[model samples]
Each structure stands twice: as structure tokens, then as C-alpha cells.
Target: MTQYLAKYFALHRKLVLPGIGFFNTSTQPAQLEFVEKTLHAPVHTINFWQDENVADNNFISFLIKETGLNHYETINKFSQFITGLKEKLQSGVALKIPGLGILTNNENGYSFNPENLQQYFPGITAERVIRQNAQHSVRVGEDEKTSVEMHEMLNKEVVKDRWWIGAIVLAVVGVAAILYYYLSR
Candidate 1:
């Protein structure tokens, strides 16, 4: 029963335990830390909301199929289970759902603390690798160009801009040579 509930929540990423609360799983995408040069792994968080109006029709149907029980029997069994949990919660006992989290009745209302998934899903150390001279497609405005082609084009422009400097140096060297020849003669 608990295992089936956990399995259903895992598969659907959402679960509604009637008269209690609803659970939802949200994903935080992996991020790159530029200064640290590390890529952080994505995280999946299970959030519990105390919404009493959440419908459990789909969940009941799922349990019926999984438990191989008729709809009325399944409902009766699940209602009994929920009633037991409610009784314990009202008596100031924290209920821990296996593979889920701890649910406690607080001064404010029902408070839920999610399980730490890091133990089951450990983060791996991922480092960013950048190739300096690698040729890859890049979008330049609306046109696609190879990185090598762009590098060549940029280098050509640099050389073209500095052509006058080389010409001036050569002219100075030629004038010095002419001066030496004329003085020697």
C-alpha cells in the first residue's frame, strides 16, 4: 500500500493523499558556475501542499488497478488508512510516509518536511571543458559560420589594418640603405 503510493508518486511526479495534502515534484535544471568552473547537477524537489480540495479520482483508479481490488474495496481500505493517520496526527504524533517525508500537525496547520534525496541521488563532480581551436558552428547574426572560418576572417582583417605599419618600416629600411650607398660613393 505505502509502496504502491510511493511508486505511483514516483511515476506520475504528483500525488494527492485525500484529507491530507498533495505532493508535486519540480525540477531545477543543472547550472554552470563560471567562476568555480563547475556544472551543478539538476535537482528534483518534492513539494507538499495542504490543499484539501485536491481530487483523488485518478489516484484511486491507479490503486484499484495495482491492488487488484474492486473500486469500493480499495476506497474503503484507503479511507481507513487515512483515518488512522489522521488519528495519530491529531494525537500529536508525526507520521512518516515511507520514501516520502515526515508529516506533522503543527500549531499553524499540517507541516510537511520532504525527504533528503541527496542520499539516493548523489551529485557528481562535473567540470566544463572548452576547446580553444575547435571548429564548431556558430550563429553570426542569422547566418551560420564555422569557428575556424570566423577566426580566419578576423585574422585577415587584423593583418589588413596593420599593413601600413609594415610598409612604413620597409620604407625606412630602404632609405637607410640608400643613404649608406650614397655616402660610400
Candidate 2:
């Protein structure tokens, strides 16, 4: 169930729980830091909002069609799940959705502290940064500057071509699994 929810969040970008809240994805843009000498990768975070009174629309039909589950049963399952989640939040317990962050209620409403994946890009792993900013300003010929540029470009390619983010990815997945198991129980 949690797996499907994660997948749906990834694919659809928005998921509404019948009486709990809806989850959507927001983008953090890539940035280049000249002073820091680093290029930050863009990433996505889950944004959750509570709206208990909203009507079921195309999402319901989409879920039923996609999962091949009975419409009423699907609704009931989601309803029960949302009810339990609400009860937990009302009880002052934080709910953690895998790949997402902790969901808790406050005086205003529910808030989600999204897990940061800022270091990793989709399908690209963050690699060990090997370049150090030059300590002193030095005059360089056009050919030398071009060579440096090519070296930086090649380094970026190497980082993108490798699958080195496996450990971080697994750790996140593991944490999500633990949270899911703990919550589902």
C-alpha cells in the first residue's frame, strides 16, 4: 500500500487522501555557487495539505482503473487509512511517509517536514567533489581556460555516469521501510 502510494506520488505528482490530506511534489531548482565552487542539483519534495471536505474526482476513477480494485473497496481502504492517520496526528504523533518527511498537526493545521534529497538528482548520483577553487588569481591563456572548462565538464559527466548514490538511496529506502512497518502496525 505504501509502495503504491509512493509510486503514485512519483507518477501523478499529487495524491489526495479521502479525509486526511493531499500530497504534491514541488521542485527545488538547480543552482551554481561561484563562491562555494559547487553546482547544486535540483530535487523534488512532497508537499501535503489537509482538506477533509474535498470531493473525489478523476483521482478515484484513476486509482480504480490503474489498480483494478473495486471502487468502493478502494475508497474504504483509503478512508480507513486516512482516519487512522488523522487519529495519530490528533494524538500528537508524527507520521512519516517513506521518501517524504514527517507529517504532524499544529494549531494552524497539518505540516509536512519533507526529507531533503537536494544532493541527489533523479538518475544522477552525487559524487565526491574533487575540485578545489584556485587559491590565487592567476592569469591564464585562452587555451588553458578552455582546458580547465573541458576538465570540469568531463568531471560532471563522470559523476552523472556513475551509480554511486546507491548507499544514500538505500538508506533512505530503508528508513522509509522502517517507518512504513512501524506505522502500518
Candidate 3:
């Protein structure tokens, strides 16, 4: 029965046990670590809440379909399983839901400790590669521009700032020419 619940939770990413609460699975997308130069794998996390008021219609329907049992039988079987879980929790035994995590009844409420399944997923080395002259799309405000175009625009601004250097060189050349001509004469 625990296996069925775990299988259903794995397939649907959600489960709502009528008398207990709800379980939900959320995924964090793979991320690139700039400092480590590695691409981390995506992570799937399960969360549980001990709200007795939550509905379990979808879970009941899924169980009915998977177990080949009628609605009443399915509900009965599921309730029996939940009753066992509740009894264990009430007796101070932590319930370990396979493939999910451990659940314990704390002073406040039910506390869930999710299993660390990261050992099954591995990350790969992914170094950042940026080509200097490579043309790529870049978003600048509301407009899209290419890398090469932006590079040229930036260089033009730099050239404008250094315009005085060219003027100073021409002035020095003119002064040398004038001195040479007067000395020759």
C-alpha cells in the first residue's frame, strides 16, 4: 500500500491522503555555477502538509484505476493504510514513506524530513565560453542588438573620446615642419 502511494506520488507528483494531508513535488531547474564551472542537475523536492480538510478525490480516482478496485473498495483500502500510518505515528514511531521521506508527529504537528536523493543525480563540468568576436543576440532595454554591433558602437564612443590625441599629433608635426623649413632657408 505504501508502494502504491509512492508510485502514485512519483507518477502524478501529488497525493492527498484523506485523513492525513497532502503531498506535492516541486522541481528546481538545473543551474550553472560560474565559480565552480559546473552545471548542477535539476532537483525534485517533496513537501507535505497535515491538513485534514484537504480533498483526496484525484488520489482516490487514481487508486481506483491503478488497483483495479471499485470506488468503495479503493477508499476502504486506502483508509486502512492511512489508519496504520496514524497508529504508528501516535505510538511515537516515525513513518518512512518509501521514495519520499520520513514523517514524525512533533509537538506542534506533523514534521516531514525529505530524503536526500542527490546521490542518484550527478552534475557535469560546464565552463563558461564567451567568444570575443562572436555574434549573438543581446537585449538592450526594449531593443535587441547583436554583439558585434554593440562592440562597434562602444568602440566608436572610445574613438570620440581620443579625438584630441590625433589633433595633438598633427600640431606637433606642423611645428616640426615649420622649424625645418625656416632652418633650411
lDDT of 1 at 90: 90
Residue-wise lDDT of candidate 3 within 112-179, one digit each (tens)?
Answer: 99887676788888866777677889999999999888888877844347888899999999999999
Q: What is the overall TM-score of model 3 with all chains considered together?
A: 0.65
Structure candidate 3, residue pairs in collision:
none
The C-alpha RMSD in Å for every predicted model, in order, reads 5.9, 31.6, 6.5
| Model 1 local distance difference test score | 0.86
lDDT of 1 by residue, 5-107 (tens): 8999988999898887899899998777777666667788889989776777988999999999999999999999888888999999998887789999988
Query: Candidate 2: where are CA atoms >4 Å away?
Result: 33-37, 65-67, 122-185
The ten-residue window of minimal lDDT in model 2 covers 135-144
Write the number of the candidate with greater lDDT, choosing between 1 and 2: 1
Reference-based TM-score of each model: 0.66, 0.55, 0.65
Clashes of each: 0, 0, 0
Give the clash total for candidate 1. Answer: 0
Q: What C-alpha root-mean-square deviation, in Å, does candidate 1 show against the real structure?
A: 5.9
How far out, in Å, is residue 182 in model 3?
Answer: 14
Error of 3 at 79 (Å): 1.0
Over 1-185, each residue of candidate 2 has an lDDT whose tens digit, in order, gives 66666667777888776767787888878776666656667767777788887655666676687778998987887678778888999999998887667889899988888877664553333456555654333346543345456556568844355465888899999999999999999
